[model samples]
Target chain A: MQEKVHVSGGTALSEQDVHSGEIFMTEDSLDCAFAWDTGVAINRYLTELKNGRIIATECRHCNRIMLPPRLFCELCFKPSSGWVYINDTGVVNTFSICHVHWDASRIKEGEKPYLPAVIEIDGASAGMGIMQLLGEVEPEKIKFGMKVKAVWKPENERTGSITDIKYFKPI
Target chain B: MAILERITRNIDNRFWDPGSEAFPVKNRYTAGMAGQRFFKEIKENGKIFGSKCQSCKITYVPARIYCERCFERLEEWVDVGTEGTIYSFTVVYKTKSGKPKESPSIIVAVKIADGLLIHRLNGCSVEDIQIGMPVKAEFKPKAERRGGIEDIKYFKPL
Candidate 1:
């Protein structure tokens, strides 16, 4: 979100005002709270994650398989034919080293930076991938087209979230 | 393509949470320089202050760093008195939701100190409020103050 300058006009306060925690400073939060509908596709996908599996959709008309499956085939312009279990093993399509968090806060020194990438699952059609994180690999060792496999959490500990598969590691 | 005909019968409330699904994003706000002093004065000292623009010679409230009109750097802090005359007012009888308020509220734009502060007026009924009537700010108790606009509870007729 873009920031608007109030009448304080940027130069109004001193650094002490922030650090001092004196008379003026107040701590609070604005909640952008709302319920999200994960829909038929993601709901089933997340449910499968809890069971230590990956689900995909097959478009019978085009024979294209999609990971993180969707109910409708954008290409075929119709509902997908059926569900298909995808191999959690896949090849890293592309990757990047993230130095900052979503809030742009610096990733502190000594903490490993996150490795974010898209992995093209084995059973999904070519070029179809799920964006996820990489683990158990050094920064310099990761490469494009590297064979990787999802590391699932203990079955009982799994939640219906993408984090159910802790991270993808080089196979 | 109806993926699975068997799954269709039980799809009604399968994924939707009526209200439990809240994605909470946290945020913080910092009162800038001019605002810091303004809120601090009321919270710590229970006094209202404003900054003076030497170029325009106008003492503006909610102390500003730069003059809006002349763009002059305002450095002089003035003790803008809390007491001011009622410049104008409105008797609001409805809540934000368009429902009748439990009691009619008197909101006033008071010409106080060097500038004007718009706040709710208390200790009087709507008929007792009038233009040019003197009013003074009643600040919140020190410990409960958080250095925001709420520092001043409301202005009341003196």
Candidate 2:
């Protein structure tokens, strides 16, 4: 029997807000956030605390691991054939200081004005990483290739959530 | 795509909920008291507020606990005007429940007085609203406020 599927049509631009300096066309500014994918359900990693964990699917063919855990492997065009446990400790491969809280609801509720970083987990292959919050490290002290380790919640307190590890810290 | 689904029907839900049995129950996220109070304010008051950086004049709409500009802890709150302009927007044709509403809901990025807010646009037809159009914030009915994002309902043209 054949199965049915629903495909969402691409969204149309509903509005725009443009600003420009009266004196110069070079100063034109446009700011917009597309009303796309407001809600999503992605597979997240489980940590010792109630913190969420992010898992990576490894492709046996290429021995490549994918983070943000997708179902397929891009390297060998193969589906995820296996799963691997990743070490919580990693280095700050790259990071950014978010000066603005992008979402009003989250910001008003006090979700922003924090740093978001992408870390290369220890023992995880290159290109396999997790995006998470870092604590104990000041914003000014954060630097590229900084050694850090996951501070997992105590064994008795762990609940297979990312919050299990309160946050990462310098090694 | 159809072929993929036909072969994976049995495993679809399994793959979707690998860590389903943990925390606050499956699919449900719990917030702290502060978060709860924040949403309650949105339901009760039509106004939105952001944290103001004491060091810098930057205002974060939907306030932040810390200053984004100066990396300072911000404990003060300031109310932004309920009114703002549409920064960007889109009309959603489908909803999660499978049943579609008669009118397409317009979701917009509205620049409230202090910061930008993303919410649904109500009170007017989607055609009537345009980018850079002025709008005012309004609360959903008290009974309809679910202590969630829907609490504010949507922004409407002023």
Residue B97 CA displacement from its true place in model 1, Å: 16
Cα lDDT tens digits for candidate 1, A19-118: 7667255566654444566777887888999999999999989999987798888987888888999899999999999999777899999989999999
Please compute DockQ, using alpha carbons, for every candidate against the native two-chain complex.
0.30, 0.02
lDDT of 2 by residue, A1-171 (tens): 787677843533222411211111112223222222111122233321234344555677787766655456667676666555566678887888675644332444544457778888876678566887788877899989888887766767875445677778888
Kindly report which residue stretches of model 1 are placed more than 4 angstroms away from their true locations once superposed: A1-17, A20-26, A31-34, A60-63, A74-78, A97-113, B2-135, B140-153
CA lDDT of every candidate: 0.84, 0.63
Residues B85-139 of candidate 2 have per-residue lDDT tens digits of: 9999998887756688776889899986457889988887866878999988777
Give the distance in Å from residue B5's predicted Cα in candidate 2 to where it truly belongs: 24
Candidate 2: segments with Cα more than 4 A from true spot: A1-171, B1-27, B30-37, B96-101, B142-146
Least accurate 10 contiguous residues by lDDT in model 1 chain A: A23-32
Residue pairs of candidate 1 with colliding backbone atoms? A12-B33, A13-B33
| Residue A31, model 1: Cα distance from true site in angstroms | 5.5
Best by lDDT: 1
TM-score of each: 0.60, 0.39
Q: By summed lDDT, which 10 consecutive residues of candidate 2 chain A come out lowest?
A: A17-26
